[model samples]
Every structure is written in structure tokens, then in C-alpha cells.
Target: MPDPCSAIVHPCLPQNIFPLFAPRPWTLNTLHIIHRRAALARLLNPSLRLHAITYSPFSTTPLHISTPALLVCLAHPCLLGFSPLPAHPITTWHCQSPQSPPSPSRPPCCHACSPAPPPQVPVERWEEAQFTWEPFHQWVMNTSVYRRAVHRNYPMSYPCGVWANHFYKFVFIRNRKAASTTVTDNFDKCHYENSDPRLCIEVVSLNRLKERGVDPAVMWRDYFVFTTSRNPWSRAGSSYDYCSTKWARTDGPCRQPPFSAFSRDPSILGKISNLFHCFDRVGMYHDYYHTEPVAPCITTETGLPAVDYIIRYENLSSDLPEAVRIINQRRDPSLPPLPEPKIYWKKKGQAARSHEEQGVESNTAALVGHGDKYHKCGMQCVRDIYEYFRVDFELFKIPLPEADPAGDR
Candidate 1:
């Protein structure tokens, strides 16, 4: 078949008939109004027998192009018509079958040419379920709040790669200082933009947004959401350190100075730990199963639930594969793959270099403030996320490893 992208332009005749003198195999079926005059001339010519529209009635005029290049005229066909003496002059021609023309009290027009059918689904309900997850996976990875929390807490990490085409909704309610960046990067890598108008859309979040006058499920319907969390004590310190960095900054409350310095005195740290825990005091001890879950610090602000997936900063690499597998089992193949999974790190002393190369200086107060608030808000977010989703930590099958607090026991 000839490529339609390189078709020729032409005009039509008064009778709305197209003429073609050449004898050859032609398959063109439709024409636009602009080229109606030229197309009509071709149909009138005797040598070329225009192919009538398929399933057309007897005496119905047949129209076909002699060459594939002739298809351009179909882009803009002209229609003329006229009524009797008491009415307006009619010069409109039915581009479609006149026998089944559109309403005439209005402008004389015809139905838009039918477009080709979409690709067939491999299976009925099964296919729908699979494609449902692609958008869901995308929603999970797009949360800025989740990504910020992950990058701040984890040492070095990146998102996991997409393993398969199928996926369903994913909800990632990031906890303070978890490996959420890795997950975010992976989501960015998975899919490409699609122009199709039929695909479903969904939204994923760190927490539910309903109670705050936002419905996450409805807002993200036909979509997926996802997020992660961190070990509480470690998360608190990481949040504190990140806020103190003076390089990464955002708007939020409760962020203050001296972020890099962890005061040995718990009293001093407690003073500033309103939303999140006192990192300086809790940084060295605390475990999830050993203690009751802490109340969320920023739950009122974001209206997000705790995390659905409480990914431990200590076990992200091992735990990520299962998440990918679940996604693959649910979505369609057209969605993009997640980015390659790896540990991403700010090189030692590289933050200053980044700012220098960009010809900009990092603001000490701004960066520190953002980092501190991120954790304080993130921890509460994760708790609500997990509770809302009813996702048990056992599904991740992550085993905690022993830690050496002194750098060498």
C-alpha cells in the first residue's frame, strides 16, 4: 500500500464526480471538501470506473482514486446543495450517502468518515485488567512529596526498572527518609506519552486526600498510586541532616537552622521536633515492631494517609523486585518501563560543586528548612498511607539487617 503521508492534493467538479483516465488498481475511498471539485472531475471521466462506497445502494455514485497519491483530496471535500424557490439556494452535496444525510434545517453536512478500528485486545476482561495498571503505576511514581522524602532519607538509591507490561493502581505514601527517589525514577522510565484519547487515567498518593476535601480515589480513578516509608529513628535523623544541608529547599513550616548539627542533648533536639521525632535523641535507637507506630506529624496539612508500602531504607534493593513483579502482572505493554534501578548519591562535597557549576549559591536556611519539614510531614504521611491501604509489611518479605552504630563493633 502507498503511504498516505505523501498523497497529492486535487479539486473536484460541480456534479460532485471525480474523473480518472488511467487504468490501475486504486483503493482511495474518502475525500475532503477542499478537493471536491477535482475529485468530481475524476469520477465523471469514462476511462476510470470509480469504486462505489462499500455496501452502497444501486444507482449510488461510485467514487475511487486511481492512485494512492490522489487520497489528499479526501481531506477536504466540498458539499453543495439547493432548495426550491421559497427557500435558500441549495448548493450542498452529500459527501456521505445522501439517502442517510444529517439534519437539513441546519447547515447541509454529512457524517464524518468512520475511522479504522483500534488494535484488538488480546483477551477481554483479562486485557482490560492488565492495561488498568499502567496508569496506576505512573501515578505512584509521580508524587513530588514522596520523591523528596525518599531522596532525603536513603543513602544512595534509584527506582526499579519495569519488568513487564501489565500493572494496576499503585499507591506510594512515602514515609520520612525512605527510598522513594529510586521508586520515582523508575516510574519516569516506564512509559512514553500516548496520543490516544481512550486510555484510562489514575492518581496515586502518599496518603488519601478525601478528608481534606479531596477524593484521591475519584481524583485518581482509572489510575494507580504508590509511596514508601523509612525506619522511624533513622528517618528522623536523615530528615534533620537533609534539612540542614542548605542545598535542597522547599516551602513548609517547622524548618529551622543548625540542621547539620545533631545536638547530643535530647532537650535541645526535642524543642524543634514538633512534627517529626527529635532526631538527635531518637537517631540511635527505635524499631517498628518493637514500638507502637507513632502518630503522624503532618497529617492535618496534606490529608494523606500513611504509606501503603513502608519500604525500609535498609532493605530497598531487596524489596523492590516484588513491587515490579506485581506491576507487571497487571498493566498493558504499551506503557513505558521504569528507569534502571541503582543507588544514586550526592558525591562527597558535590552539593557545593553543583551550585557553583550552576552559577548559583545554595541558601543555608531554605535548604535546611525544607529538609526538616519533609521528614516531619513524610513520617505521618506514610502511617496514614499504610493504614488506609491495609497493606501488611509482610508482603514485602524484607529482613532487617544488623546495624553497627559505632562504625565498628
Candidate 2:
């Protein structure tokens, strides 16, 4: 059987034409003329099979011509009997069925054929088909809250203020100086079936958890998350006093330095120099008490807030129980009520006496009075401290303290 792709000739072409061309020398020029005529014949009747006639002296049968030569023949009109070809030319014709439809893998005829136009797609569908990163990139850029919270060194980076309780299927972000120890301790007791309230739950850092094969994405999705925020100025003062006393007991360079000396060394030459060097000796204190914005800690990968609730440390007495209720409802509605946190005065030694002696009725009043000593050096020093923690004030909706414009120096 002939090859499936071989050209076919229409029966209308004279059968005797093959013998006239068979006797000629089969040179390149002779072959070209045959191909040209065959191509023209194909064009005239696409249904026709056009073949090149070639003969060897030893055989009566014509040699099989290549498909390429036959295709080239389709290009010349004279070969199709539209006009007379050169007398020396040899041409053969065969009667066979017209070629079958081109295979799916192969394109149809040469220049005369074109690919079908691509299937039309709806505009919305096309847009959706494209993969673009702009939306995701924008979300990442909008994580200003997370960025601010991590600006200062904390124990953890990704989950800045978070404390996880796997047993309760919840995570609590304990803001610095916001009674975190109390909150975390209560969770610890709950985790151990209330066996030992003082077991001290270890607040794991996000990075460390990841290193241990815990995926943050999974944790965020599976756990109920929450955080607390405090009044920035009050928190700042409390942090300062806490760090001062804590460091005094240690042999650290910043130990026991007066807030005035700590803010800026009087002997520092440049104006901005003192500001930069302000917390150098007590860098640990600075890191621990830095402005931790709540947004970053609770933000999802899409830059949306991920926490189920936010408790205000200022109203923690009332707010915490409500937050606990929400968590319990989501996890196991039958869980027992959370124990009330024991409120303890954090001020110890001189700081405790100072607050008592001043007869300060509120934490805010006590912190402001304690923080006032730092301002003795100059309002600029206080301004510098405020600027360092400016994000905390802005994020938590706390008002900034009034500054003396003339005393910026």
C-alpha cells in the first residue's frame, strides 16, 4: 500500500503523459520541472494526486518521488496544465484518492494554509489566568504594624508577643510590661490540668517553633489568637523603672544608671550623639521595653489582622475574662472559666516605696511621676524617649505628651 501522506492525482489527467516524461535524463533541472508541474496540478484541483515520473533504464516502473519535491511542484501553475510546460520536461500523473485531512500533529498545506484563530477567551477569564504578584506584594508592604513591633529586639521575631498554649488550642500575645507573666502563668496552669499553677509556661518564639518543625501558617489557622495593648506612656515609665531595678542587680554596664544619665551622657559632644547613645549601655532594657505595636504580632500572611480578640491591659481586669470566654467558645464551650489573674504591684524596693510615698492612686499617675525624673535633664531627652516609642503611642491610640518646642535642644 502507498504511504498515507503520498500525493494523489485526479483521473482526469491523461495516463499517457507519464510515458512521455519517463525517457528523459533525471537531472536536478529535470526533477525541478516535474515538481513544478505537479505542484500546479495540485493547485488546480486540490483533490488531485500529482506525482513526479522518474524511470531507470532497468525498470519499467517509475521511481517513487519524495513528498517535498511533490509539494514544490504544487507551486508552479504551468505544471497544472494551466499553460504548456517546456518540451523537455518529464511529468507523471497518477489517479488516487485525494489526500486525507492533515494529521492533528502536522499542519496542513504550506503558504495557502493558516492555523485556526486561537479560541476566544473572556476578558475576565484571561485576567484571572495571568499570575501577578502585585496584590500579594502590596499586602506585605502594608504590614507596618508587624514592622514596627519587630523594630526593637524581642525574644522572638515573627510572633513577637505571642504565647502559645497547645493544650487549649489558643495563643496569647503578652505585651511587654502588660502583666504578661500573670497571663502566661494562668495559661500554663490550664495547660497542665491545673496541677501546678506555678509550672511557668515557656513563651516560645516563632523562629524557634519553626526550627522545631512547627509551621506558623498551620498554627495561625488552627489556634485562636489574641494580644493585649497598654497605654504607651504609662507602659514606657513602668518599663523604665522595671529595667532600672532589674539591671541594678546584674553586673551589666547599664546597671543602676540614673534615667538622666542613661538618656544622654552630659559630656557627649554632638546633639544627636547623646540620643543615639542613650540606650547603648542598657540595650537589653531598650529591646525588652521597645514600642511593640499589636498589629504586627497578630497579622496574617495577607496582612490582615489574625487575632480573634484584643484585650486592653488597661482594662485587663474586665477585658481578659471576656477574651477568655471567646476562646473557650471557639475551642471547647464546656471548658471551665479562666481563673482571675492575681494583680500584684510590680514596683519593688525604692520604686515601690516611691509610689506608696507619693500616694498615687492609679498606675498612670504612678508611672508619670516615676517617668518625670527622666525629664529633669531636659524636655529633649523626654522627647527622644517618646520618639523611640512613637509607634507604640500611635498604634495603641495613646496621646503623645506635650513637648516644649524651645527646649528641643
Candidate 3:
């Protein structure tokens, strides 16, 4: 039979916990040294440490040595067979000279150090910046007194500060492809509980509702106003694609693609015409012009303060705090959560490259509708829309892409 110590097993423990186990040859003094060694290693480097190594009963070994050194053959029956003592004496020694310092480790050179590699940026650093705001978005959403819900229909009376005398209400004038749905959702959440109708509004185009001869003021007093816009070219393109495809149901006219069946063929011009006739103060989407366009909506048109705040679709995420501030400041304390800005397309790079490579014309009608004849009318229509809401456009800091320099041919 083999020696009784032959079956001794050295169970692996984490290096940090090594001190807890008595050192062999199972003596009180060796155990004390083991604990001290672990503490010393930890103090040297808390973040990096050597994984513990195993021992065997076959041969003599040292207690400690640096630089990938291993100690072995110290037997202890108490560790495995429940014996109380170690089988041998253990010694420690420095493998290298006492006065010499260790050599630095050399890292393998590879693609990481390539010349065109991205610059190394330190983690956990952020730029400090400050924000300024107008009255509408300044304090509206967060003011505790305003978040309460009250009863009544179109306009609910608000009880707070200078706004206490007036009834507050809002209308979400949803324009096609103009992020109106997101606006509607945010307003819907502003009231207390799901049952409160204070935050709800029937979203329809201004033109459609105005025909009913409703007082625009009575219809939209004291409420926050919001809308969105896109680059005209992209908007026209999107309108055409939606009106011609199955995806039209998502935003555009829902009565089927042939929305112009009775009037005229649904061309790009028709789509733009439909959009112009649909909403009030439709702002540009490509560059958000909330500073000007939405401001007027919150303020009175005859220039009295009516609407509370506006959010640009392009910078909606960053612009949300502004909206909250305005709403909380003027209207209600309980502002609804802001909706994430919705993006229609994702692979813009591939789509743009393909469009460029294919040399696709924006308008199907040459210079006319899709071609030459439609070009003149298209240009005029675009200008009319711009002039109608120049204040909104100008304030948002988005310069309308300079109109085609040639003008209407």
C-alpha cells in the first residue's frame, strides 16, 4: 500500500482566502506566515493578483516565490482526511537577487497600434454645459401645482400663479409625416390617471377643423402646442412612397393610395398640396425650427400667449427638458413623459448611395409635375409654405436649404 500521506489532496482556494487555511506542515507558526503573505500580496496590488496554485504530497516545496513560481509537496492530512497537522516543514526564498528590480512585461505588437487607429479617450469624462429657455418651456412640466387634473371639456381651468384666470386646453394638429402622433401621445399622458380627459385632444388638421368655424382661440386656449417637419425633398419623397405603397397606413391618407382619384393623379405635387392643406404651422423636420414656429403656437397668433411649448423632431430628445420646463412653468406640474423621436428610415447611407448611383430624379414628372411643367408650380407651392411660417423656420436656426437657385422656370 502507498504511504498514508500519498492520498493527501490540495484543494484550490482563491489567493485572497489562502490565509484562512493553516499552512503545512500543519503548524501554528506557518499558518501565521501564510496569512501575512496573502495580506502583503493584496497590499501590493489590489486589482491584479495571481491565481492560486495546487500542491502535492510527492516532494518538498517553498512557501513563497515571485514570478510564476510554484511551491509543492507540502502534505497536510487535516486538509483532506480531517487530521489536525501538516506533514512537513516549508521554506520561502527570493528566486532572484534581493537588490534587483523586476523587468517590465513586454506586450505583443499587433493591429491595436496601427497608425490609423482611433484616438484613445479617457472614460467617465463629460462636458459641462448650461441651458437657457423662454417662458413656455421654462417651468411648466415640473411645477408641482400644475400636474393636477380637473374636469370640463375643451378647456379646463388652471389654478396657479398668473395663469389662474384662464382655462387651459390643447389641440394636436397632426400633419402627415410630421411626428404629430408622438406629440399627441405626450399630451395624452399629461393628466392624472388614465381616466382623466384633461390631457386628451382630437388630433385633426387645422384646415379640416377650421371649416367648422370653431374659434381657434376658444378651441386652443391655454394649452401647449406641438408639431414636427422634415426636409421638403425627403418629405415629398416619403409622401409619394407611402401613397403608392402598403406602408401608407402608418401615417399618410388611410383611404387607399389613390387619395387623388377624383381630383388628379396622386403625384408628388399632389402629396405636397395635401400636406399644405392639412395642418397649421407645419415646421421643418430636417432641422427643427421649434424656437420660432412652436413658440407662436404657445403664444397667441394675434401675438397673445396661447400655446405653451414646441419640440423640434430633429432635436426632440435634447429638446424634451425644455418642453417639460415650459409646460411645468405655465400650464401643469404633471407633464407626460416625452416620446422618443421616431425615425422613418435607418439605413440612410445605403439608400443615399443607391439613389446617387442610380441617378434617380426626385420628381417623377420632369420639370412639370414629375418633369418640367410641374416644376414651376412645385417651387411656388414650397415658397408659399415657407413664407407662411417664416418665423417658425427662422427661430429654429434651420436655414431652409436655399431654394433651387434657378427659380420657377
Candidate 4:
């Protein structure tokens, strides 16, 4: 068979004009070949009118290219030099029946050709294109308090809670008691150790970076910022359990208080409030767990969220991998998939027993040991906690536990 890319010369065209017709890559379809010939004919004789007959690839019927002089080129075989013909008048010819074999006087008919189908787009690519930032922008607009804070030009009073893995261009806003340790550990495993002594020793927040004269705006634009959020009530319960347990071992005033007592204790509450005021307060060494509201921690100096994505703790198992995949794809399309982080936490029974042995009746244990304490807290306590972290529940879309019609107490 002739190469599809080779040029076809027509006897009608002058030698000087024939050399100008360049070969184009095309398949051997009857209609395409006829169209090319028709185009050439038009270029050679601009006044000549032509009619092209097209056929389906499956049909064995032959097509005829008719000119103004009522001349028909049979199966377009003469153009391919398959048979002898007069040069000047473009002598017409005919093809034998499909059942008959080709004779010296006639050539086989050219098959009809259809254009190739377009390439398929990858599903991930489709998803990326369809994804929109509109919903997130709308959510930010709905947050009235956050909007006010941003508009009022108030300086962020608390640490911005951002942690960075410079090597991977990963930034995470740490929410106390929101599986921060798991997130930090996973990043450390995937990339080089964060060597800045301040961050090397502990997770650094965006505000901390600002205090050290490091501009967070650069990281905000340059890195992929992400953070995990837990339901506000559950986060509070976890904070109480983790912090009370830690402080109980030390000489702090909040030492060993059960959840119920701790929630009501004036001294502990005052200290917790003061800790928020003092941005330098470290949760590990202080009585406070650094339970800053989730909104403030994730918000940048400009009042916008510092991170690009928020991975909910409720769906962390699935969401974390997705976030990692998106980040990896953005950084390097050829990078291999990252292994999912293995998360392990103490069982409720073990946690309760450990706390009990430490001489404190775990409030978490008193309130269903394994479940959320939001439902177990009295109405007054719920209201107080809700009022305290109201912005977190509203901004993050963490639903409030349904109140019992008959008061919580």
C-alpha cells in the first residue's frame, strides 16, 4: 500500500503547479481522498465546480466525483495511476460490480473513511477542572464574626497555629486535640526533618513565625496549607481529657480535676482564658491546652484562611489521602502515590483505667467513656462552652448536639 503521507499527482495539473501540492498525513478513506483531490482541483482551476459523493466505511458501494462537464471519475482509480486514461479532457471510467474481480481496464474501489475519535480526559483532570472556590468564599462571607475581625483591622491576638514542612511545601494549621500529632508525624515521615530549632523542638504556628520575623504571607502563597478540624464539642472533651491528664502529673492548680469539676472550676477556667491571652503559652508545660478557637488558628493576618484545604477529623481516613494526592499532583505529576498514615490511639477502656489509677475520676469516663461528652454535659455547661467556641462551630460547620427538650440536667 502507498504511504498515507505521500503526495498524489494529478495528470491535469501543470508540472510547475504539481510540485506545490504537499502531502498531508491522512487515512485511506474514499471521501478524504476525494476531498483532497477536489481541493487540488479548485486550486488548479478556481472556476471549476465539483460534486463529491461520500459513502460509509461498511458499504461496498463506490463513489463518483462529478465535474461541471458531466464527467465522472470511476472509483477515483485513474488519479492513483491504477489504469491508463486521456490526459486533457480527464476521461471518465467505471468500476466493476463488488462481486467481480478487478480487471486491467478497472481498479478496486476506495473504502469510505471516518475521522478518529477525540482523546479521553483523565477523571482526576476532570475533577480538578470542575472544582470551584466559590463555595468556600461564600462560607467565609457567612461567617459574620470572622468577617468583622478581618474588616476591623484588629491584630491577631493568638498564635496562628500553622506548622510547616518546608521540604514538601506543606503547611498545616494545628488545632489542639485534633490529631495534630498524627499530622506532624506523617509529614515528618514523608519529608526531611524541620531543622529550625524553634520548629524542630515543637510545632510552630503562623503567629510564632511572625514573632520570629518570618513572613507567613510568603508560605501562604508558596506552600499548600491544610488543617484538620474536629466537632467543637468533641474537641473540647478531648482537650479536657488530654490537658487534665497532663496537668494532673504536675503541680498545677488544674491537676487531676475530673471533666465535670474541671468544667465548673473558676481557677482552671481563668487560667485557660489567660493562656489564650498569652500567645507564648505552651500546652505541654502550662495548665492550658492551648484550645484556641479553630477559626483564629486557621485564619491568616488578612482574615482569610491560611490553608488551602481543611481535612475534617470526621472523615480523616478518606480525606487525608485525598489531600495528599492533590498536593502531590500539584508538586510533581510523576511522583508516586504516598502511603496513607497509620493512626493509632488508646482505647477508651485503657484511657479510663489509666486516668482512674492516677487518682482522678475521668470526666470523660463519667460521661459515656467511649462517646462524645457534648450530649452528657448539662445545659448550662453546653451553653457556656458553645458561647466560648461559637465561631468554631459556625465557621467549621460542626453541628451542635441536639438538646434534650427536657433540660440537659
Measured on C-alpha atoms, candidate 3 has an lDDT of 0.31
TM-score of model number 1:
0.28
TM-score of each: 0.28, 0.44, 0.29, 0.45
Reference-based TM-score, model 4: 0.45
In model 1, how large is the Cα lDDT of residue 112?
A: 30
Q: Assess the local accuracy of residue 54 in candidate 3 as a C-alpha lDDT between 0 and 100.
A: 35
- For residue 398, give model 3's deviation from the true position in Å: 6.0
lDDT of 4 by residue, 121-190 (tens): 1112112333344543343344332443222112122333445655445566666665566667664432
lDDT of 4 at 246: 38
Writing each residue's lDDT as its tens digit, candidate 2 over 74-122 gives: 3322222311123322232222334434333222232122122111111
Ranking by TM-score: 4, 2, 3, 1
Model 4 off-target regions past 4 Å? 1-158, 189-218, 248-255, 258-261, 264-285, 301-303, 333-337, 346-376, 399-402, 407-409
* lDDT (Cα, tens digit) per residue for candidate 3, span 1-409: 4333233334422233332333333322222223323223333234323233333211112234322221223222111111111111111111222333333221121111111111111111100111123332222222223643421111111111011111233333333443445544454432336734443444233343466454443433223443344433333334443332322233454333332231122222323333443222332121112112232332222333222233333333334444444344444446553334343322222323355455753221111122221243455544543443454444333354456666642
Error of 1 at 145 (Å): 29
**Candidate 1 lDDT (Cα, whole model)?**
0.31
Score candidate 2 by lDDT.
0.42
Q: Write the residue-wise lDDT of candidate 1 on 173-220 in tens digits.
A: 333345555555554323346622222222222232332343432322
Q: Which segments of model 2 are wrong by more than 4 Å?
A: 1-161, 189-215, 248-255, 258-306, 345-353, 356-359, 362-371, 374-378, 404-409
Candidate number achieving the greatest TM-score relative to the actual structure: 4
Model 3 lowest lDDT segment of ten:
118-127
